[model samples]
Target: MNIGVIIIIVISLISIAGFSRPELIYKYQFNAWQIKNRKEYIRWISHGFFHADWVHLAINMFVLWSFSKAVIYYFMRSLPGNSSIVFLVFFFSAIVASSTFSYFKEKNNYNYNAIGASGAVSAVVFASILYDPFRIIYLYFIPIPGIVLGIGYLVYSRIMSKRNVDNIGHDAHFWGAVYGFVFPILLNPSLLGHFFNELLAIF
Candidate 1:
């Protein structure tokens, strides 16, 4: 099994367990106040293992599974040694990095809490887009190029983050997607040139 799928399975099981045990949610879910007052820093990464509901878990897993191979392929092909380990680091760190902005922004709002893998999934999706800019991605069952979907995703997430009208963690999604695009390039700077080359070819 691919590392990405393995991660999905692990998180799915944990999330399912969390659904039945409210305490699990309380213990693992991202709570800005808990971290600020109690020093429960684990919430930063632990939150990725829980979700608001099964639907939320399913959607995030599906997207992650869909794009996992592309990201893993590019990483293994371009980087030296232990690609799986490297990818795992990229994935988990993204979960935390994506939420760092929110942690500081909401730490004092005792009611602020979030649960889901959307942030990590968004990171995986954008990373895949970086590798295959012209690949086909289904947007609401309609075929659209990956690059187009990526742009739409970024814009929508940014706007939604600013509005904060919904419970959704658009902030995490936006930052995660940004991290996804940059982390790989950090691993291999050549990817920056490759990204531009593929982007221009899309014209």
Candidate 2:
């Protein structure tokens, strides 16, 4: 794993501990991580690791692992404008960005707390989509592939978010996915050999 992913895993473990240890977690750890205000938004950056349950951790980390290869592989290639570090900056930044976006918009909701690596994980998955929209990716037991399902989920999240369904942060997930899909194209439109040559030439 890259530094970005390793750091995220470590944070996720710590967040899990904090979430499970209410008294100790709060006392020893910074309270800002629980989705606080501008003064505490720094916590939002690290808050993606904390999960509501074991199931959440398993799913998020599993997806992270599954998709990390494509993202990291794409990022490791050479290109103009520092393509070497493309995925790291985009992945980690998107997580923090997504958290901040989620909190920044819903701060007034009072009950709008956030957690999980879905924001970053979604970025990885959506990045895959941008790379190859027709690629197949199974969701749990389903085998519909990611493009169809990913687009479907994006729309679903937006609709459900508009409806304000339950406690879901659909906006964060959607926007995170959007960032994942966009950053790659914007940074390196070539996306491969020809794209790389043309992009590098511009720089």
Candidate 3:
């Protein structure tokens, strides 16, 4: 079983559990106040395993499923035997990295809470984008290059994060995407040149 499928199954099961038990979501969902004051630090990683609703869960899992294979393929090519370990670390670390900004921003706001795998999912997506910049990604039924969509996503997330106009964790999405794109380059700096070469090929 591939790591991505395992992740989907695990997250789906936990999310289903949260569906049946609202209190589970309340306890595990990202709450900066709990982490900061109560020291419930596990929420940093735990929140990514559950979600707000079926739709939310479906969307995240779907995106993860779609992008994970490509990311894993690239990882395997780059790191060989240690690729799975590296991929697992990348995924989980992205969850924590994505939430770090929110933890600091909302530490004092007890009412602020978020639940979903979107942060980690965003990481997977942007990682795939790094590998295949010119690949087509259908956004709301419109076809666009992966690189274009990635840039647009970052811009939108940044704007919305600043606006703070909705319940969506735009900050998480922004940071997760950034971490996803950077983590691979950090692992193997040569990948940065490969990314640029891929872009140059299309232009």
**Candidate 2 TM-score, C-alpha based:** 0.78
- Candidate 2 runs further than 4 Å off: 1-5, 23-38, 78-85, 192-203
Q: Pick by lDDT: which candidate is best?
A: 3
Predicted structure 3: lDDT: 0.92
Predictions in order: lDDT: 0.90, 0.67, 0.92
Model 3 / residue 99 / CA error / Å: 0.4
Q: Candidate 2: lDDT over CA atoms?
A: 0.67
C-alpha lDDT of residue 55 in model 1: 88
- Give per-model TM-scores: 0.97, 0.78, 0.97
Task: Write model 2 residue lDDT over 24-131, tens digit each, in one string.
Answer: 333332233344544654555555656667777777887887777766666666334444366667767887766555655665665446666688788888887766
Residue 102's C-alpha lDDT in candidate 3?
93
lDDT of 2 at 92: 71
Model 1 vs. true fold: TM: 0.97
**Root-mean-square deviation of every model:** 1.0, 5.6, 1.0
Residue-by-residue lDDT tens digits, candidate 3, 47-154: 999988889999999999988888899999985467778889999999999999999999999999998889889999999988889889998889999999999999
